[model samples]
Target: MEKNTILEQLRAAKAAHINWVQRAKMLISGFKMEEDAIPVNSTQCKFGQWFYSDAQRLNGLRNNPLDCMSEIEKLHFELHDIYLNIYKIYYDLEPQGFFSKLFGKKKKITDDSVKLAKEYFASMEEVSKKLVNEINLMERRIVALPDTDLETL
Candidate 1:
């Protein structure tokens, strides 16, 4: 939890989120990825893992919890919720056991479905921007603190 360490983790988390968004766009573009690769859960993705774990120690950044933390969490969850919609549009390949692959038809990728997924991604980008800004705000606030206080981190 050193100040610079926290800042680096924050930067990595933001990059992780950006990568996830790119994967979603790839899905919409028809290059479907496997489920294990890109997690769709709010609390399971890479950034989510960092947020709930390492970022928890970031709480008492000022003896008062960082307000930006809550905002980032909210936006993070919203971003995943939006991603769920996009996932369903493309990857809802319902498992009907072996027969699903043998007989079940792939869901036709409709123009409308792609359009909708792209729209969801657009929303995610906006949410991601806000999330990044809040993270930057937190970084700035922590950097502004005295090194003695940061040492306590």
Candidate 2:
């Protein structure tokens, strides 16, 4: 591929990733606030759990596009590792599905779970910042490359 074409693709990926991270942050923040508003033991809390599960799934899905970009650029970004960590935390906090709730197997959302959620949100924010930095560095490198070297690639 031509250098300019590759750079354009990278820029697009960067924009998409940034937007994804921003949306994720908004979801997490909204969920956190909502979760805090409801009593942990209330039946209504189940809805929050469901929302969290969906958010986790969404976050997991978002990681793939960024990973593709990372692979294409031959760079292993810290965001990828952080996303894995976030996934693990979500897995640990996985909410009971409809059948599980119907069967009375709902997991209790304790204060510890709330703390963990906050930690997860912080980790996600960190990943977002790191990803922005990494993308900026990648863009700088691409821009700095000589025309001769760019053409060779």
Candidate 3:
């Protein structure tokens, strides 16, 4: 791809990463509120499951930009791995079903779940920052390259 095109894609990816970070923060806040609001008599709180769905949607938002950069740099691969890990963590914490719902057994949020969510959000924020930095560095490098070198690139 041309350097300009690559830079444009990187900018888009940076934007997506920023948006994802915001969504992740919102999810964290929502999760906390939901955890706090769970009634003693309630079973099968939908918060965890809702979070999973929302997280999946947020994950999807980056797919287009990420796909565009798949072959551009190793950093893209690292970002992909980080995204997958986040999804895996969320998946593991997905609410239990069937019997618990039927029996009115509360799907209590364990300390482990809270810890994992906090860690995952932090990792996601870090990764997003890294992506933005990488994009900025790439833009600077591209700007610094001579016309001949740019043509060759």
Count of residue pairs whose backbone atoms collide, per candidate: 0, 0, 0
lDDT tens per residue, model 1, 36-148: 56788888889999999988876755675477888988999999889888878866546656876577546777899899989998998899889888888887887777766
State the lDDT of candidate 3 residue by residue for 67-144, as single tens digits.
Answer: 322222344444445545444443334676888657755445556765776776677667656656755765575555
TM-score order of candidates, top first? 1, 2, 3
Cand. 1 TM to true fold: 0.87
**Would you list the clashing residue pairs of candidate 3?**
none
Which predicted model would earn the best TM-score?
1
For each candidate, give its TM-score against the true structure: 0.87, 0.48, 0.47
lDDT of 1 at 129: 88
Candidate with more favorable, higher TM-score: 1 or 3? 1
Where model 1 places Cα greater than 4 Å from the true spot, the runs are: 93-105
Residue 19, candidate 1: how far off, in angstroms? 0.7
TM-score of 2: 0.48
Q: lDDT values of the candidates?
A: 0.81, 0.46, 0.46
User: Who wins the lDDT comparison?
Assistant: 1
Please report how far candidate 3 places residue 78 from its true position, in Å: 3.6
Model 2, range 52-86, lDDT digits (tens) per residue?
33212222332223233343222223444444443
